[model samples]
Target: MSTSDAVTTQSPALSSEDRSARIAVTVFPLLILAAFAIAMITPDTFKPLAPGVNWALGVIMFGMGLTLTLPDFGLIVKRPLPVLVGVVAQYLIMPLVGWALCYVFGLPDAVAVGVILVGCAPGGTASNVISYLAKADVALSVTMTSISTLLAPLMTPLLTAWLVGNRMPVDGAAMDILLMVLAPVLGGFIVRFVAGKFVEKILPLLPWISVFGICYVLLVVVSGSVNKILTSGALIIAVVICHNLLGYLFG
Candidate 1:
């Protein structure tokens, strides 16, 4: 192949959607850092927003749903291997790693329990958007997230009990998870079905909506824990970051 042809094929000019996703991905880390600072500095501000965080998450998931098409799900059947691998790895790796971290850090019982819970929990709602921004397989990400989440009610309780010696009341949170996460996503898909063209027109904007919503979630949740964060936040933050890096490396 010719050099220019090779270059053209290898690095084509980004489409408007690609550009937007790129920009959002670039800004995402800075936004989260800023949100963390704001949350820590004025924790009281986010206290009021706590009640509505689930709604905010639903809105974000709805946006994620809007960006999808029926064909996006074809991969689940056509290529199931990746989905299976992702789900299995997610369930197996993160929980054990969290337990190991808690032990290594000598974390308090409450903090250790929290980490274990997070480990056993399915991927966050923001994962789809993050996956999109990273140019990863969104369909695979969505499917894995859904599968892991559906499995959580059983897996979480068992894993938490084994690791932390305290069983999580998954029965209670199970309904909330469905209503808050899956329901909104389903609603979004329905809307997309009814108005495919309109949804396509607005697809480019979904990443920004997701980014803003997730950042707000971070601030609110972090703000609520400002006291604990301030008291021994450094250790927690360090361990969390280390845990994340390890997950990335292994997963």
Candidate 2:
């Protein structure tokens, strides 16, 4: 093969992995929707798993971390401007948009609080998986998530107080988040370093695992509030969907 052909062509195995990742992304939302249905239909079944949601999130983060290398961190340092912009958007843009949605939608006090809280929250761990599936910069996503999470303890309460007149709790959340988010990620990073080749072979499997893990997490989360979900009016749902979509579009 000529030099250009060598540069342009992909190995069959790599092509397969790309296909699998694409399929995972395509089906991810459907699986999550089904999880919601199951939760709504049989909320009690998933209730017992409620306590493990944080740990489940941790496992998903671990899978994401295994895909990383020391070079990923180096990339973050090398390109600090984009990382700062992403972090700023995660905190400033999303939260303000959420608060605006609440006011425009005329959400009830309790529901408005929920919306604002979610907005004020850190970058969700799931974004890293989605970014990987999209073949985007997972390292940047991880770095952004880590920074947002670290800022959340302070920013969440401050934003809530400014927007909702009530301070969200700031105590002990950092330690728990470190365990569920940062610690598992570091452990996976180290494990990948120790078993680099084996981990590379399994990288394609991670997306599939993430699909089911995310479904289970969604199911467990929705099950915990089935009654509330059922009672929530269409307006609340519309506001939430708007907030989510707008956050993505603007961010």
Candidate 3:
């Protein structure tokens, strides 16, 4: 066949890799919304599971790890400056922005703390996909995410303690956060390493798994907040929207 003919025959739509990554990017938030809806509709069946929510987050982190390779780290080692800049930008920008917003808007303590928590969170795995879509530096985005997440066990608590200390009791236990977040991520990485070819074959399904995990977390949070939400629905929605928008803008 002519080269022109072959070129013409190629599909212009998204490749499998693109489609899977999109799903991975979207699943978590969608699940969160779905879970919240379920909780709102049937609170009895949707009792909050705080620990389970944590575990689901861990699973999502692990799924992220499974997609990584040693070279991803190499990017950091080779070009330390950009990665450092990204990490610093990530750590400083979000939390401070959140803090400023809370102060300026006169958010209550609990709501303020919630905003801080979301801001203090590291760059999510979804950011890599977003960066790709925006034609930004994917490597930098992934590196920032990986390093920030690895640092979460330390940074999250420290930032939380520093920002929300007056508002709430901050547990400055890096080890606990590490065990809660990194353990699952490392475990998933090891599993992927061991199952190499098998993992490659089933990689397409990771997005679905991540989506389910996120939904579970949202459900747990929403279920826990049902009474408060019912009583202060407008306030709760406002806080959530502001928190999310700020994270995206400053993240």
On TM-score, the leading prediction is 1
Model 3, range 54-116, lDDT digits (tens) per residue? 667777777666766567667768889998888998889888888887887788887788788
Off by over 4 Å in 2: 1-13
In candidate 3, how many Å is residue 17 off?
A: 4.7
**Model 3 regions lying over 4 Å from their true place:** 1-17, 23-31, 48-51, 121-173
Sort order, lDDT high to low: 2, 1, 3
List per-prediction Cα lDDT, in the order shown.
0.85, 0.85, 0.71
Q: Model 1, range 1-251, lDDT digits (tens) per residue?
A: 99998887885788777888889999999999999989988999889999889988999889877766789897578989988999988888999999999999999988888888888888868778798777677777878888888887888889889988865565678667767767888889899999998887887898898899999899899988888888998998898998899899999
- TM-score for candidate 2, please give it: 0.91
* Candidate 1 displacement at residue 96 in angstroms: 0.6
Put down candidate 2 lDDT per residue, 22-45, tens digits, no spaces. 999999888888989889999899
Task: Please give the distance, in angstroms, between residue 54's alpha carbon in candidate 2 and its true position after superposition.
Answer: 2.3
lDDT of 3 at 117: 81
Candidate 1 has a TM-score of 0.92
TM-score order, best first, reads: 1, 2, 3
